[model samples]
Target: MVTIHELFQNDGQKSRIGTTYNKILYVPESVLQTIREYLDAQSESEYQGEDNTIIYTAKFPDGREMDIKCCGCQEESSWTEAVLFDEKGYQLTYTDVGEKFEGLWELEYDGIHYCVDVKPERNNSKMED
Candidate 1:
């Protein structure tokens, strides 16, 4: 029952706001651990140089299942884009990780903007908005 909020910031005022999409997901802790392990493994490997897609399964509390997909480059670059798709194959979220701002990243999902220090791990951490 973990909740994730999309955060936005005002550059001029340096203020932040959180917007909850009222999205809820019912995912097992084991699944989260698996996702973390997969990402950690990918981070340690050379697969990033090639086009890679990591797929995993998630189930909702009401018994709906989804296939989560993450696509990105594994190269050491100043900037990279990772796109996540929903179970219906719709583009669920877009993330830009670049050196233009060190240790910062931007995310757009469901037509909303979010400023995050770290990329949301998998399929918005298996969230449903």
Candidate 2:
């Protein structure tokens, strides 16, 4: 172990940390593809979300599964998150492609490809006059 003085004086950012996954999020195939092509063409999607369903795996190409969150958004902006996990259930990486996700985009992590695709449903109610 390095001392506190050595940490500040010398290189202190040389340590590696490990993490664990407590939950898994999944997304639909069509939804994910749309998100992947967002940069190429700006578009909109209408998702259906009346029931609270906890997704376990995503319907992806090559039959590989991943976790993506699908929440309803009836506002100006929404939040989307996609977490990639290995077969052993260890989280490899994640992506936040909603809200202010712009500029140079890195769609791959640990040799795997992924992007942001949050399916937020819109359920409106009319008031009687």
Best by lDDT: 1
Worst 10 residues of 2 by lDDT: 120-129
CA displacement after TM-score superposition, residue 71 of candidate 1 (Å) = 5.0
The model with the greatest TM-score is 2
Candidate 1 Cα misplacement greater than 4 A, ranges: 1-20, 42-93, 97-129
Estimate the TM-score of every prediction. Answer: 0.30, 0.31
Supply the TM-score for candidate 2. Answer: 0.31
For each candidate, what is the lDDT?
A: 0.39, 0.38
Tens-digit lDDT string for candidate 1 (38-120):
44443435333335544443333322233334333455322334344455656566554322211233444554443323223
lDDT (tens digit, per residue) of candidate 2 on 1-129:
111121232555643332211211233445555443432333234332324322334433323345554333432223445556656667767666543222222245543444333333224421100
What overall lDDT, based on C-alpha atoms, would model 1 receive against the true structure?
A: 0.39
Query: What's each prediction's clash count?
Result: 1, 3
